[model samples]
Target: MDVSFLGGPHPQRGVGVVAPFDFALDRELWRWVPAEVSLHLTRTPFVPVEVSLDLARLVSEHETLGDAVRALNAVAPEVVAYACTSGSFVGGVAGEKAMREAMTRAGALPSLTTSGALLDALTELGARRIALVTPYTVSVTQSLEEYLAEAGITVTDRAFMGLTRHIWKVPYRDVADMARRAARGHADALFIS
Candidate 1:
């Protein structure tokens, strides 16, 4: 990307990823996606703002997320991704759309959330049966499974990585292997945390 476009870049192309804490994308996504835009990281700290799987619960609590969204919009990111997949889907398409609408209405900016992107990606990939691997407890992870199922795709199998899912410099290949092991089943593809 042109350096001038992204907040007067230092080295990498500047893309602002405005999200709540714990909203990290898998390396696999970047492997296939466009690389012209790089991300500038900013977020609500985890200690202050907990990640909520329930979309309504999330929205109800964090009314400031709208202001956060507007602040990110002011940064003029090439793509402003909301970055919470399960929470958005827990609200369903309408919920995701409503979140985007609130952001745009507050700032007149276009945005995409992980939940919308997942469904879109699934549609693009033509996946029917899928394996779900999340970094949530069983109850929340099952909510995600149900969320996906409500979208018409079946969750053939599932595994949770507990509430705190992290990698202390573990290699991507190792993570992939763990994901594969965790979600071993006769299914289409797997969603790894």
Candidate 2:
């Protein structure tokens, strides 16, 4: 018998991520993927608009995301994903569909977004009431709650740090505390938005 194997990050599959210019959790995202999967990333232009309406407008732009998806397609990834939650959810369910359609049309591959994925996950878990946790301002976090409500998932409780800058600086212990607080209610599941 012959046995053959190689060591050190054998990337057998590639996933393209169309991300925001300010996305800072690259390491966290990579950690969730299997070692056999490689990530190809392209960033869309982002203006510094922290307000809910302005930020929604900035992220919901199909043209910007389409260009980014096309660029990622040059790498021939098996799938493309829009990694921004706010951008994906701001337009509601219909808008999310359009965003996915645009990405697929641009790259000729399967496409999804963070918000869409979240909805799928929640449904798969049969979670009816969710405790929300976020590092965004109250207004932005409330918008997320509203989006989830549109999907018929009730929010039992929520925690927000009201942060707009230096999100990377938040301590894990603090996050854990917030999570604990959010889980205090009678929620079926916890969602960190």
Candidate 3:
């Protein structure tokens, strides 16, 4: 008698990521994911409309998210996560809930958004006061601040780059400096949004 063994990926051990068209930190996420798990990422359509409420509104549309989620659902991920912070918060708290629910329905699994994840992290850490740092313009940064405020987080200090384009082009050194400056004020933690 002869016997053979077949090996393949384990069930319910992979993660699905839905990113915005302009996202550039996929490598970072990949580097951090545990080797035992697989990462499946999909990008939603984006027009690169400067980082602002307008940009947020455009990217957070349910129609676009539905298409993106449908595409990711083909892989049958155990959990789906939306990786765009602005897109997740642009619609406010209710909008974030709706987006997560839509992804859950389309991907047929539990879903998470960047804003939701951030809030969870903050809550877990008991950090209600935050210093915000971002490469977005004042208007865009303000919108994010408002979203956090709705969640009961206070923005004690902030630093903005006021750049409307090429946020990914920013250097890491500059980002570090911005974060330091933003955290100068008394706060529980610094949030680089």
Candidate 4:
């Protein structure tokens, strides 16, 4: 009956995550995290707008990010990650950098955005050309393409769903089909946004 030998819970390091209000991939995010680390996630304020360039801009405003980062600071995460793909890329590279800087200024922690991480991964893999798949309208998808291009990566092919809302509900079969369509051309990688 003596279970005291188990001791208290292990100390956990945390990564603060600022996700869009509609984000539904918390489990997916946790899958990549190590057992010893924890994710402290916060969402941007909900807005009436559906998923679009305007919505992306709204959710990722500097003031919004700063507020989210400050809230996460209470948990003392070692680093912060802005987890919206569209919001991060809609502003392009410069915007991504500014978002990180703003989060750092608010929380005094290292910060990164999803678009920045994507670029870093591409560079690490030496993937100069890629095929893109997104559940965004043409305009939003084009913004992502422009963002990638600014990072010197070419989009060799692409497929989009033209979706405005509930992107998390997209069926895996449909996504697979879209990926298949996008990957038909020569590409160093396939990026699903």
Local distance difference test values of all predictions, in order = 0.62, 0.85, 0.85, 0.94
lDDT at 121, model 1: 84
Candidate 3's residue-wise lDDT over 1-193, tens digit each?
Answer: 1223554544436788888788888887878887666788888786857677787778878878788888877777788888888889888889999999988877678999999999999999999999999888888788889899999999999998998777888899998999988898889989997
Model 2: lDDT to the true structure: 0.85
Output the lDDT of residue 6, model 3.
57
Tens digits of per-residue lDDT, candidate 2, 1-193, equal: 1224755444468999988877888988988997678899988886876636467658668898889988987889999999888788888888889999988898889999999999999999999999988888877787788889999999999999988766767888999999999999999999886
Q: For model 4, how does the per-residue alpha-carbon lDDT over 1-193 read when each residue is reduced to its tens digit?
A: 2234578567789999999999998988998998789999999999999899999999999999999999999999999999999999988899999999999999998999999999999999999999999999999999999999999999999999999998989989999999999999999999999
TM-score: model 2 vs. ground truth: 0.91
Query: TM-scores of the models, in the given order?
Result: 0.73, 0.91, 0.91, 0.96
Badly placed stretches (over 4 Å) of model 2 are 1-11
Best by lDDT: 4
Q: Which candidate comes out best when scored by TM-score? A: 4
The local distance difference test score of model 4 is 0.94
* Candidate 1 lDDT (Cα, 0 to 1): 0.62
Number of residue pairs clashing in candidate 2, backbone atoms closer than 3 angstroms, sequence gap of 3 or more or interchain: 0
